[model samples]
Target: MTSPAELLALYDSQQRLVVPEHPPAGVTFEVTDGVMRVTGRGEGFVETTQHLGLSGGELDALIAKHRDHFAARGEAVEWKTRAHDLPADIPQRLERTGFEAQEKEAVLVGHTSDLLVARPLPAGVVIRETNDHNDIVGLSTMLSEVWNDDLSWLIEQLEAQLAAAPELTVLFVAEAEGTIVSGARIEFTPGSDFAGLWGGSTAPAWQGKGIYGALAAARAQRAQQRGVRFLQVDASPESSPILQRRGFVEITSTTPYIWSPSAPLGTQS
Candidate 1:
């Protein structure tokens, strides 16, 4: 049995603070003072190691560097922080530096074999894997309907991921009566033991009908096929409990602290 601590250790060792060896076109990766900064594509992201051995002043300077990096390009940046990360005050530091905290999410991990078990789907609903541009666009449309926000970024991101590494990314959708009701994806980490199962968005009428869990299982099955050992999800509050019930171990919490130039230092918006 894989303990939560063991899984978390594995996650932190392999997934945390990674540099993109083959960054997709228009993207650049930089590592400075234990932080990996990803820039381009109109948005930036910053990730740091679990143990950032820095004094308060050093950490503050590092945070300011992140701010300046994005501010120069006039683009927003999302600083990814995990609950167990050190200096132990990184989230507060981000906020004091004008980063707005987004929704906190549960970091869930489970063995691929554990989630590979077949699950029941709603009547007449079928989970299908897709790589077509049309299906990708349709999935973004259906997801926007569920979240009531334009998910145009999803389409571009998915397409970019697929084009960058077709073998590493796949899209899935749940269709009922020929209409898309749910969407999901699996992204295999090229050199890691984990595959990310992400984006389970279901129609309001389709929620709680087992579509979410079914989509998860489908993606897990894909992970198993890829010889991945574990599946991971940064689950929203609404989906966290559901993923927990499906055998994923709750490891830690994560929140994205976003900052843009319009929101200057010492303020959040």
Candidate 2:
């Protein structure tokens, strides 16, 4: 069992390393006055803020810079803020600077051993790990239906990521009658003992049937096999309690402040 403090420390350290201040291929990264800005093809984000002591005017200017940068590329940008981030007023600043605050999520952490308990899947449901394109498309489509949002971008991103670094990413899906009902992906942090769980989605009809727990268990087993130490997730309120029952602890909260070119500065709507 890993202590919360230890898990948090691992998270902080691994985050800085895995999520680099520099841009990866096909993305742009810029750092100004200790604020790191990243812009991809369809989205952008602000992170790695070092000088949280900046005045309101400076913060506003920083936000505008990122907005214009992403707008040039016709991309919507998100400023991801964690509760433990410094200066303590960053979230308020982002809200005041035309960034609409999105849903708040619990950052859950747990040891792989704690989540690897054997659980029987629902009758006729089986979990499979795959890097195949068709399987990825099925999983993405299921998630799109689950969240009621277009997740085609997810398919593109997953295909590219798996092709570029197969060892760093794994896709898992729960299938019934050869159709994906629940799906999730795990990403391993190179040179770190942390693996992140993302896109945990189950069909509405499949909810409360222990399908998610089984999916999580499968990922945990894979993580243990890879010698990973900790598993982390940004869990929604609905999923937080379920994760808690599996030994995951809420270490902090994270919220995304989004800015679009169409929206006026200092206004959410």
Candidate 3:
């Protein structure tokens, strides 16, 4: 069994403070003072080093600067901070600077081999990899129906990602009788030992049928084939429990502090 401390250490050392190997077209990246900013996709994000030794004033200054960076582009932004990150007041500072906290997720880490064992899926449910335009659009439509949100944006994003590097992102869908019941994807960070599992939502009728776990196992199998050491998930409350039962360890917690121009200034202030 891997300790949470060791998993976190491995994650911080390899995943953080590294620039992307192949940035997609029209997407740009910048790193300064141990903070990395990704922009030019209409929605930008900020990722940081594991530790920052800034004082209160310095922290506030850093937040305001990145906040302005996105504001100038007329784009929304997300700042990802982990619970174990230093300067515990990071979230407070972000809120004070007009960022609103979104969903809280468990930082789940587990060895891929632990999940490689076979998982049985319900009859009539077939899991398959999809990158075709029509299939991608169908999968996006299915996800929007599952979440009751307009997630059409995913269509273009997924297309761009596949176009840029097919090896980095893989999308899988659970199909039943020609209808898309569930969709999910695994993302491998370039040159890293970890891969991320994202977007495993099933249709209302498809929930509780073991499809999600099957998708996870499939993704983990792919990760193992790629020589990945661990699989990571920023799991929601609903998913955290399920993943926890499957040998995944909760190393820490993370919440995205997001800011949008359409929203008010100081929404969290």
TM-score of 2: 0.90
Error of 1 at 124 (Å): 3.5
Task: Tell me the RMSD of model 1 versus the true structure.
Answer: 2.2
lDDT of 2 by residue, 27-127 (tens): 66666666777667477878754336766676667667777777788778888888888777777877776789899999999888878875677899988
- In model 1, state the lDDT of residue 262: 92
Superposed on all Cα atoms, the candidates' RMSDs to the truth, in angstroms, are 2.2, 2.7, 1.9
Candidate 1 at residue 106, lDDT?
95
Q: Write out the backbone clash pairs for model 3.
A: none
- Candidate-wise lDDT, in order: 0.84, 0.79, 0.86
- What tens-digit string does per-residue lDDT give for candidate 1 at 1-269? 88999999999998887665566667788887778998876789999999999857778888898899889889999999999998888888888889999999999998887776655886799989888888888888988887788987777777877787777778898889888888988877778999888777988998888888788878888888778999989999998887787688889999999998899687421
Worst ten in a row by lDDT for model 3: 260-269
Give the per-residue lDDT digits (tens) of candidate 3, residues 1-269. 66889888888987776666777777788998889998877688997887888867888888888898888889899999999998888998888888899999999998897677646888888999989898788888988887799989888878887888888889998899988888899999877879989888888898888888889888999998889999999999998898888889998899999988875655222
Arrange candidates by lDDT, descending. Answer: 3, 1, 2
| For model 2, the run of ten residues with the poorest summed lDDT | 16-25
